[model samples]
Target chain A: MGNVGNVWAVVAIALVAVATFSLGYRGSRHASTTQDFLVARRTVRSRRNAAAVSGEYLSAASFLGVAGLVLKDGVDALWYPIGFTAGYLALMLFVAAPLRRSGAYTLPDFVEARLSSRPLRRVSTAFVLVIGVLYLVPQMQGAGLTLGMVLHTPGWVGALLVAVIVVVNVFGGGMRAITVVQAFQYWLKLFAISTPVFVMCAVFIGSGGTHGGESRGLAEPLPPTFSAPTSIDVTTPVTLRVVEPVWLSAEGRVDGGSARGPVFWGPGTHEVDADTKLMFPGGAPVPSVAGTPSTNAEWLTPTGGGTSDLWTTYSLIFALFLGTMGLPHVLVRFYTNRDGKSARRTTLHVLLLLGLFYLFPMIMGLLSRLYVPELLVTGKTDAAVLALPGKFLSGTLGEILGAVTAAGAFAAFLSTSSGLLVSVAGVLSTDILKGRVRDFRYAAALAGAVPVVIAVFVRPNDISMSIGMTFAVAASTFCPVLVLGIWWRKLTPAGAGVGMTTGGLCVLGALVATTVSGYTGNWAPWYLQQPALITVPIAFFTMILVSKATQRSVPADVNRFRLRMHAPDPLGFIRDRDVARFGTAEERARLAEGRHRR
Target chain B: MTTTEQKPDWEEVQASPDFVLLRRRLRRFVFPMAGLFLVWYLLYVLLADYAPGFMSTRLFGNINIGLVFGLLQFVSTFVITMLYVRHANKNLDPVAEKIRNEVESRGEEK
Candidate 1:
């Protein structure tokens, strides 16, 4: 409805990109060596590292998709943001310090170093690629959506632009550059998202917040109504389920097919084609994207005494809570901290920062349910954040706020993909390819290219739900391996290899089965779709049992490895082979005796 | 060969009184704190999913039990971080740093 915002959005986005590359180039200028490119010795202070982590972690999912989910899915959607922030808590408690102490830069390196198996390293690298690609797809798609909305170029333009910028930046500075850009993006994203909510809330409060211009509560049993006469533009063909028939005029393809003239719709399902615009009167009950709850009662309550939501909810909780530690980028960021103590503290600060950030999305989501109820018509709730500001403010100020959200959403795509590509490149260069400078650039190029292709071809799902699936896979696979490797000494390389494959394969198979079967119903045994409840335990059990069976295959240095990992960093008991030649005669003698016995 | 001569007696250190005490104290904090938080979180999740009526009961200003439960998850995380940091600073860090210094000094007596 508001075309005035596009200019502001374009300017804001250009500013973000310029800042990203300028800051990115500064790091690349200093990073000549592969070591510096991949894991720079720049041990950022805890506060800054925490900010960068927050920046990288807050992708399209948190900025745009969370509120969208709120508009479409109702109160059940709040769990995602809560679980996302809480995932860091679990990470801090179980994995953060020990993982940082392990001193292996990437997941594959950590697995290979911990288990002493090259094959296991290969397995880890494969999973890294899968999770990396799975995670990146949504980022690219969201970029495409935001750019398409702002620039009116094809959606692929945004995805390609993000990919190209990320690849170029990675080739220039790699990990070192990414950390600075992400930290900057984190603050920018917070400002872009929060300022609109604050402005909207003042408007709502000043105008005496209520329903139907009366004092009706937010949770009252009524369908959301338009605050004003609204027009919904369907960019993709959407089958909207209208509850109460209203006089609506469409300018493009309606059920009658093509009509440059206006067409009317009745109180039933109707197919509106791409590029169609429908104008409705003020106070009309908003039509919903087919299959979404339209009333406040249905929306506010999560489930209707069903076992399906029960299964999905628990599995979702499991995935989101346990999955953060498994993300390669999240763990890699921990290495930027000076030591385990700082790593723990950095994670703690991330919790505080993330908690503050997640609160705004809830407000934005609630605001959208009232002001932008037409978003439910097209099922593109992801655009809810972008549309709400323009709806509320409706002038230069509205356009500016809309631009702020657009810039933030764009920043989300750039910072996350950049951070993710570094992890992908790190794995590819160090493990899959040679750890050469040239290979690192190739890895970065490959990393950016594949995700963009996928993003271009595939229709974007709800950004956060796709992310939730990726988290489920990560939880089923690496969460087990990392937790077991850190706490349980009996975890053999064979067990890890088998267990990770088992967990990863279950999720992959389930993802395929559900997708192929096209099972959308809540009762469709989504066990195979979101398998954390069943698969995580199975993953842990398989590892322990397999490790027990393969007891003889355990590393000879396993005990000393525990000592190195658990002992403070100041102790020279580090896992690095290079940190030798300083042993006392007594220590040297004991080492020789142990070797002789072996 | 000097290749095998560099490592200290790790099993011996792992068995030492100080290292044992450090590991014990760390595990003592780690296991229970992790378990407590996870259970609290899971209970909240279960109530949200299964007991919807109870969770949706209005408390104040449109704030329901479910909403409060969700927010409490954030609050609990805050408390956990502060408590863990304080506990580690008071209990675990000095011990770990002390052991690191001890091991390094032992090696320095070449």
Candidate 2:
């Protein structure tokens, strides 16, 4: 099982790597100017740009994370994909054309131009860097997880390999090549997921498939518990092993109360004395295992409702939908188009491509629930898609499916890592390093290196949770800035500065608390876990209030900037006749007078 | 006689036929598409939030109504784009060419 099919998978993965690298190299030929490197010369057509956006946006999180969540939470988890796609819809309607029309390379650039202040630009840039780095962590972690699971390599080695490839491709081709690679990966990923799922479904139906039915046998319900294994030292490799399953029934209380009921221990169950629980993995309390014989379940099955569950559910929706608009990497892609019209069109295309790509992962997640539930108990749920083919299908068919999944995983890692590196590099080249073209090349390398180092030092436990945290942070900080900066004319520099700092610091503080608190405790833990439900609205309100308080000091050119943003281009639909009706003529005449006086 | 000479007529500066057609074509296509897309996207968000049962009902084995609704988000986007391209090609593009010709002709007239 280990090497038999894995060899084919590796060959397939390498082929994808070669294809992506070639596409990137070809893109490099077109990238002679700095603008070409940064924004694809603003010539990207809507359809291709949409594909590229979907490719990069899908990430390992969408590829593995949503499926994993659906497996854990049932139908409720579909909201993640819904929210994610909807965010783009929000962007298409409100932000896309306006953002592109703003003619800025990044969010910070928009801020500076809008507010006409360097300090505001600096503040926004810092927020972008923070969000970019936080976002990069999950992508790096996902790469490690995917590589380790598929290729059976050490996680760090996998992470490093991906980092190197991303750095090289990004440095060589910049945005132009990245666009091609990402667009190709979107379709590659589509084929990878769709092909296997379709084939699997056909096979399942052919084998006299029937939907799952209610369990009739008497089996004790398994209590959810987390324990670290004692045998695996810090240096020792972590691998999955089957222990005898344990089943415990609480007949009565222990220590002071009633007598407890009898418990059964069976295959695949693990047990330890209550006091010896600390000796279990991570020095955490291990729950007494009750052996239960249950049919293997699909990860996508929805469990019945609970009270505390709804908050986490809503928080997930809010974070994914609202937070999407602020992702530095995602937003930067919209800027690659030639004009606002193209940007709008590209966003529309992205919605379609993303919607199509999402279906396969959801299918895979549900299928794993039915057939390959063993992986969930083993804590390697991320590999459910990769592991499914070998379990249900075999021979050449299984091997080919395995190979395709591996290739898609590699594509996922590379496309996402490239998008992150591009954002980081943009920040460094334009904002932090403030270097020229030659310096940008060096800055790009450094940008890639910093994240790899971060990836090495900190390994997140849950890839989905880590990505969610990044989203929370982005929503809290940049979401406010973009929303307010676009719609609110009174958003003064001071207000933006305060809102960004406050929101960024608050989200960062919550992240630090979540990390230090070790995801435990009572109310504080929940708040730290999902801060966006509160933090986003607070940031929005704070920006509005602060801007109003400082309205007297608002820049005089704010109206002019707004007009430029909302005004149709000369070639666009708004002609002199329309302008006259819309009062744009008066505004333009005033602008002309002001320019004449100047 | 020289003192009584009328001021040169600015209206006599001939307008190019191409420029007028280009402006007219742009007015017909770009604005309508932009407006249509805006409505389509807003409708998607509202449907996703409120229509949970519709989204969840299965269309195929495990493929549900909600999934189709989500996928339409993409479909509508492509559909709008195709519409935009078709409109631009048939309506706006010729007008733009006309506008270009008019601008060039005006330059010659001057």
Candidate 3:
């Protein structure tokens, strides 16, 4: 809220961008060949690759959105970070090592190699672009939200700024650039996010603020009480469900009446017009948005009273648990490993890094409910983490801490957006532009530009929920293709193509239906809200049954490719063809024999 | 073609006892491990969704059954990772490297 702090945050963000560019440029010095641009020549060490993976994975959804969800919804929302981190576990178990052994630079490359079909590659490419762009929009919108909060600028300004920075970084070095920059960002983000929490925690203790055991004002049987006199500024029109009558001072219209003085809101849903300032005296139960849980008990439970919580919870779990393997950006990073063994190792480290970083957001989320209760009314709960330090810690220190969080949030947007752009660009250049570096630059521009423009126009209310829907789409489509394609040697190209199309269309249709219906209660089937539950099984069944029915269409060399994918490098069953490209004739012969198994 | 050339057919190599053994070892570990983990995870998810009161059964001041179960997911992942790595190193890697040496030496001689 301080102009000086906002100016400092802007300056810090610019410095981080410049630093990222320099780091990327340095990494790009090794990027003379396409291999360098594509998979960093598969030279990054496991630990560094793990850090980069963690950096890219902890996007706007994890950084700010998780905390906001927790603050607003209570413990039920903690499942998000858990599912997000654990998805890598599912990845490690099923996809990670084998995918690296597949020796493909991109998802489409893997699809083409495995299925041995150009048309299948084209289909895979379309899905890659869809998932990448869908994932990218949320990061851009999150950047806009952060800028709007920190600097009081138009949201598009920050979104455009992030897009330009990502495009520049990718244009400079592609995957090589993103690797070093992202690894560095992981530490920078960890430091930026955790420091304020630690400082504020100490400050909280020093000020005799006991941790935990405090009543959650909303969860109690009675209505939530404000710990102190609070002023809530309604930025958007809201219908507040009041439990107890409270006399509050209002400057704008309340329930269609322009009130300049004290007005009483009875026990019912009251429409508070936009731009209204409602001041509630201390100990009065805080009114909440209609249909959301207004008590602490409701907030803690899974069936906490919105859209059939059972269906929503299971659907979300199915999507996230299976979806991580399908995220193109995440899958692309695994290719940076030198071998299957390292890829497995890197994923193990990612699990640890993600677990550690998530703890801070959980703490911050709980802190928000205690310190920033007014966020519930403003519906800007996404800003909970950014606003917490300022709410609790006063003076110069608090402003600087807020700036730190702002910088971390910007880092989140930059690292994730850059990773998504690079993956998308990789697909575009390799599939459409013949894997040329110059083409990659053009692809980067197209990849980054589309999302930024959409983010400017179409604003999703909850950042994490939008990301969840993207996960649902990804889970339905790629998860089946990758899992069955890797494990089930019976899978045919037609089966994969049909299954993917079916899953993708079903999820897309559900998404459009849900959007068109406009969040009305029970308008769409609950499965439509979380389509993975229905679509994932459909994908698997379609692939299995069709592949069974068309066994004659199976590739003749399925067993050879299967050996190449499953066998470790020590078995010499799989080799990096890129490395063999520059080798002598005999060396190339060895690599070919390794693959062809002469 | 060299008289001593010994280029084995991919079909033979795949059906060879060594390859079969390798595939079996991998399947023996991955299938059961993946199944157990998935079941454990989904059970927690089901309980969280359907049995809210049970999940909310507090253990400590505010720490509840659900929180513990959620935290266990992270712990189980790390544990499984360690077990799989150890399993690969102990059971899978030696035979795999032996097969590689046999194939490469025979190919070079040819």
Candidate 4:
């Protein structure tokens, strides 16, 4: 089937933009000072801040990639969402209260303030840049994929569209606008993903709750069959591996030879060139793609029945569980809370919200198996969530639901990309541009520009895998420093720097090697693909060993610093008493005194 | 920026019995709980990775042990968070506030 017309998609995109900017404009009224731009003046309530965090954190990875991974890799990919939400649990337990109480606006700011070292701050800023840029690429790629499916336009159009919108939003009103905009986006995404799934479930149940296909026997390795006459237009060159000789009506290049109708394929890999249309009659089992399961049993197992699955699985868990605390955009949100208690409460709320949102994607992924199995051969499993509405329901209502899912997908890119941009711009403006609002505008431009350039050049094979790599890097590098610096008083600046550099370089080298070598199996390929399992332990040891070796360099006031971080804020009383203006002069004096001790 | 250079009397506060008690209480809750949660989470991951047969074994109609384990990750997180909040409020917060109040009130005179 051709894509739904552009009118609905354009309207949906316009509505999301109008709603986002309108909320931002309202929030901008309160945003005047640099503090307002950076941390929303520390005035946001726990519930609102939680929603904003959930919104910004979801990104296209959760919105589209989770379901996509589940579709392609089986139940094992459920770890993506589980690890993602559980990371917050780790944050709540270890990082949330302490980081908030430290009173630093950015990760770099926290590193510098905690360690009393400007050089460590510079190292952290570099990581913030790398993670921010790496994360931004997938959001851009997801945007391109969505728009190409919905609008029938070139992929780059959607990427450029999101980049411009994000830049303008960040330039106009930094963190203040982002907070309000993202809070709205969380609910929008929840509604967009769930409403359609709920509707589909209801319809399925109403229609006897019976699936539309015959059950395959346990001994069968048969490919998935088209329940109806389905015509697939290949947008790019695809190589399909057939298990048995099958007949198909074909037009354009098939097996490097042009044929018009009734082409036969043998039991081997066949290349279908770009713009080729392949028509399969009813009950013709779909051809298997090069790297995906062709049967239900294979799709249901978590490991995809591969030898390297165990190592990769543990690595993903390591990366996601530890990585959430180090995300620059996520860390910056805690600074918007009124205090440490609010930060903890906000994270709790975030855990709940993220848990609820992930459920819908998992449902969508499961439902796609029954309705959109052709996606296996197409290698567009990412489109499963978007394609389900149209495939299962054949009417105007289905088209509308499809449009709504597309809009929600766009909203995902917008909210996440904006959060990342604001964070990157906040760091750039503060460190390089001296924290001026005008300079922030320039930083905002640079923040969005670099990722857009990368997105335009590199075509992502799997959006989720790319994001998982970024998480692995973040987990390996920053997770060590934050955990050690907060809990260990003897952690010197030199140790922190060395640990971060070692971890960062190792993960980066793994990423580079894997990308260059192109997934050559064996020789510890899974370790390279998911580097956190190896790199995180190495970094932790390096930090501990280096800190032990350089105990004399530990900041002398580390005891006082720990006291400030671990202490409960008695001013929480004043904060509750006066929500609007709670950062009192007395509290400032106390903070100033505590800082002096450090 | 200016706050980084100050020198408050941290040694005095760290020596106080109240501060010592507060640290002890916090460690009691944080270390054991953090350790427990990590072990639980790691067990789930290890089981999923190594014991795929156990994980994929269907416990109900199309509802396998793996899916249940995945959902429990969410259930357990919420439960842990609530438990920690309760534990902190009862055992940790009052003592922490007491220490903070003592330190801040004294620092004000300087």
Candidate 5:
């Protein structure tokens, strides 16, 4: 099925964009000055803020990539969503209230204010930008994959489309718009995603969930089979493994040579070149993409996911759990809470919303194994959520549900892109481009264009793995300092700077080594893939040891700062001095008065 | 920004008995609880990674110990949230509110 764009899906996607834009335009009335942005933040109650956080946090990775991984690897893939959600719990317990009360917005801004070190601020900015930009690549890639699946266009078209939309919205300079639009997206996604799954479940029960009235065993010791005559368009070169010899029809390059139309595969791997088409008869065992488990029993086991072992699994857990507090967009949004208590409450609500939302994607992933296992064969498991709706239902009803999933997927790309793009732009304009020029709308556009351009050059098959790299960076570099800075009284600026620099360089080296080596398999060295296990502990120790050596440099005002950071908000000790550090005379006065009122 | 030689209000509040008690109570709840959850999650990950047989053992129809462990992560998270909220409301919020009211009425530490 090539280039068969569903009209219903296209229309539904358009509706989501229109809805987002109109709501943002309405919120623009409250967003003129930077102070007005703070007002908009404080005025939003925890429930709405939580929804917005849930909306922005659930990117294409959570929406599509998790299901894709589940399809490729078996029970092991459940850890992706669980790790993603568990991070918020750690944040709520440790970072939320204290960071909010500290009165600094971004992680870079927080460290700069807390430590009074300009170099550290610059280091922090590099991380925020690197993590922000690197994270955007997967979202764009997922968008490309989704559009390629639904609209039947080339991949680059979807990446470019999202880049332009996010840029224009941010250049308009209305954060109130993003907050309002993102909150609405949460419910939109929840409804759109769950409806098709619920419908499919109902249909499954009515039909007895079996084809030809046979009792299907989920754990049968054989590879999946095509229940019908199926044709698949292979967009990329792949090495597929067949469990047994079978006769098939082909229409493109096969086995490293040009082929007009006939195929027979032996009991091993066969190479299928890019832009090939293959036809399989009913009851043919699926020739799955190489490097994945072929049988149900293998898929169901935890260790059977190709390259997973104890070290990699535990390291991945560190990246997911400790990394939440270090994400710039997520941490910055938490600061928008009215106070520390409000921040804690908003986080709790976010945990609930995310916990409930993850269940649908997990369910969809399980259902995909039954109805859309061919996706595994094509290495396009990311499209399982969107395509399952069409595969299971065969009429206009299926088309309508496919449209809803497409719309939900589009919203996932849009909301996250907007948040991350604005964050990168804000840092660029403030720190990098300061005093160079007046307009930072140029910075916004610059930040917006870089990721899609990179996405065009490289298409990593696994979106979750790409995001896991960012999480590792966050966990290694910043998770160390944030945990230490808040609790360790003797942490000096020099120690923090050195520790962060060391951690960042180590993780970057691993990233460079892995990319240059061009090894993307489960069997690659665990240290290269899961560097956080080593880097995080090193980051913490460096900070502690260096602080011990530089004992005299601890700020004399540590007690005062701790009091302001940890005291109850109703006591009102903080005077919001961060505004004075980087605000206009008028804005500073307004912020002081605002704090006084609070 | 102020670097005063004379003790500031922060020092007074930091030394106060109520604030001391408050810090002690807050740390007691947060540190051990954070440790507990982290340890519990670590155990689950270890089992999934090292002890695959235990995790993959079929518990019922289409349900395995692995799937149940994964779902229990969600259930444990929800439970933890409820526990923290309840603990804070009952033990922490009242004392914090009382301190805030006293400080506000008395106009910044005496």
Candidate 6:
């Protein structure tokens, strides 16, 4: 029965892959020009474009990672999803229309357009590469984990397979194709998550239910070990040194504690708490436990801390809310739309789609707490979602559920990686390689290869942590650039160039410090992991101060550019007559033929 | 091609009824609502930070103030979105339509 179920799971994954490739190939037909390849000729519907945005945004981090975190950590993990979805709201309010209006293909393009500086563009391009590669690592890692769980293959093999597929898809069709695949994947993910949850709920309710009934011994006080201080920042790698294995009951209370509760361990619990000091792997000391028993089990539980862990919690929230605006993949999707209004509408759809999808993962996390508490002890918390089907139902139903999850996991990886590749390709072609398509394709392959190598070698401590690191880098650098460039018209090229370089360097420096310092008792542990609390404000202030100092350096065309951005384009804004003046023979012929036909 | 034509200031352009109504509505309601929510979210964060005891205070069986605050962050997002959509539909949409008509007519004349 397990074999049959596994075969079905494999088949389902194969079907999804084939469908995705065909869709991408079909999209390539429409992507003959660089513009079409980059932004789908800027004519995509707002609704579909929004779906693609949300779809790409919902990575392994959202689907499997958050659920796993919730299963391991408890209610505190809910913040991850909330922060992620709220990012779209921020994007809607601040970024959507202005970004579309800028008429730039990539973030670097926006930098150049806003500051009119090639040097600034180069700096932003470099940041994009770093941020893109950072983001790509988690997606690759998640792909490996998901494939390993679903197909019983080695994790590295799964990672390589996903990297190859993503590279091909992005190389073949570019942004246009990725948009279609992402939109489709969004719905696929929604169904994948929702169906099993609905089935599990029904099955649980039908079989002499465990609903709303507090089981006896489930009210024990959490042990000191369970309540020990762990590094909360998602961006920095957490090194959990288990001096001893701390066993807890399903209720997350210490197993041998006088106050008995439901014991949680193995695959079900959201977080694993061993008698270990959680720090970065290199030996930096994270926050240590103050030996306080949490008042609320839901809050005080290590994985399920109530909002008391301020730095970790707020840093995460800040990352999610502000991070969306800076994400290259999500931003590039907006450029695919027809105009500013379309971009706005697309953002609205993304909000709804993402909000709906978040509900299931939260529920899954909560359910895992109740059912699969054993998995926590194994420290294989990521498998919480994949393990759900077998725990709830057996035989054919279990296999089907497993297959659906596997497919969804792969979808999460493929959609996100493709989006990242497109963004990377855009920066390479437009900024670095000077609009050369062939060179851009080579860059795309290189981009995919770099992350795959990183994934294979580094093998990040956790998926959520890897994603958070990417967000810190993004929030520190691109977030400041986009925000300042939009609101402050006085922004000079030198100022922007300086600000971006500073912000990017600060984030990179922090990342390096955190990585090299490891779990040792180093000051870098606290500061470097959550650098945004410092670097973001610094970037903002620097940009403003620099722009003020260099106000006169602003070009004469600044006003004209602002007017063009804010005002609606006039009818025949780009007339054939205008192009004819600068036209090659082929363009002139096309214009003359169009005029004669009209 | 009249590059020398004096461009009207935003204030003068906004003196039209359509713009006036939008400006009033945005100031009186939408802006205030957004401000209030932003404050609430910030307060929640501050409390979670400085007043961990307060955040840790339990409300129901195993439910703490921090959990409620975190959940409220989710609720507030939906609330703001719904409020925005309602405002756009009831107040902003008509004004926007009028502006669109004016802009379209002006474009046609050009």
Worst 10 residues of 5 chain B by lDDT: B1-10
What does candidate 2 score in Cα RMSD to the true structure? Answer: 9.9
Give lDDT: candidate 3, residue A151: 80
TM-score of chain A of each: 0.91, 0.82, 0.93, 0.92, 0.93, 0.82
C-alpha-based local distance difference test score of model 1: 0.82
lDDT per residue (tens digit) for residues A51-145 in model 1: 99999999999998999998898778888898898799878877888777776778887787678898898998999999999999999989988
Cα miss at A28, model 5 (Å)?
0.7
Maximum-DockQ candidate = 1
**CAPRI rating of model 5:** acceptable
Question: Proportion of native contacts found in each model?
Answer: 0.58, 0.04, 0.37, 0.51, 0.53, 0.15
Per-residue lDDT of model 5, residues A48-77, tens digit only = 999999999999988998888887777778
Total clashing pairs for each candidate: 1, 30, 6, 4, 0, 42
The better-scoring model by DockQ among 2 and 4 is 4
Model 4 has an lDDT value of: 0.81
DockQ of each: 0.48, 0.07, 0.40, 0.43, 0.46, 0.21
TM-score of each: 0.92, 0.74, 0.93, 0.92, 0.92, 0.80
Tens-digit per-residue lDDT, A128-221, candidate 4? 9999999999999899989888877777888999999888877778899889999999999999999999999999889776456542332244
Worst 10 residues of 5 chain A by lDDT: A33-42
Reference contacts reproduced by model 4: 0.51
Number of the candidate with higher lDDT, 2 or 5: 5
Residues A515-546 of candidate 6: C-alpha lDDT, one tens digit per residue: 76654545575656666666777777787788
Off by over 4 Å in 3: A1-4, A210-228, A251-253, A256-260, A301-307, A519-522, A570-574, A579-598, B1-7
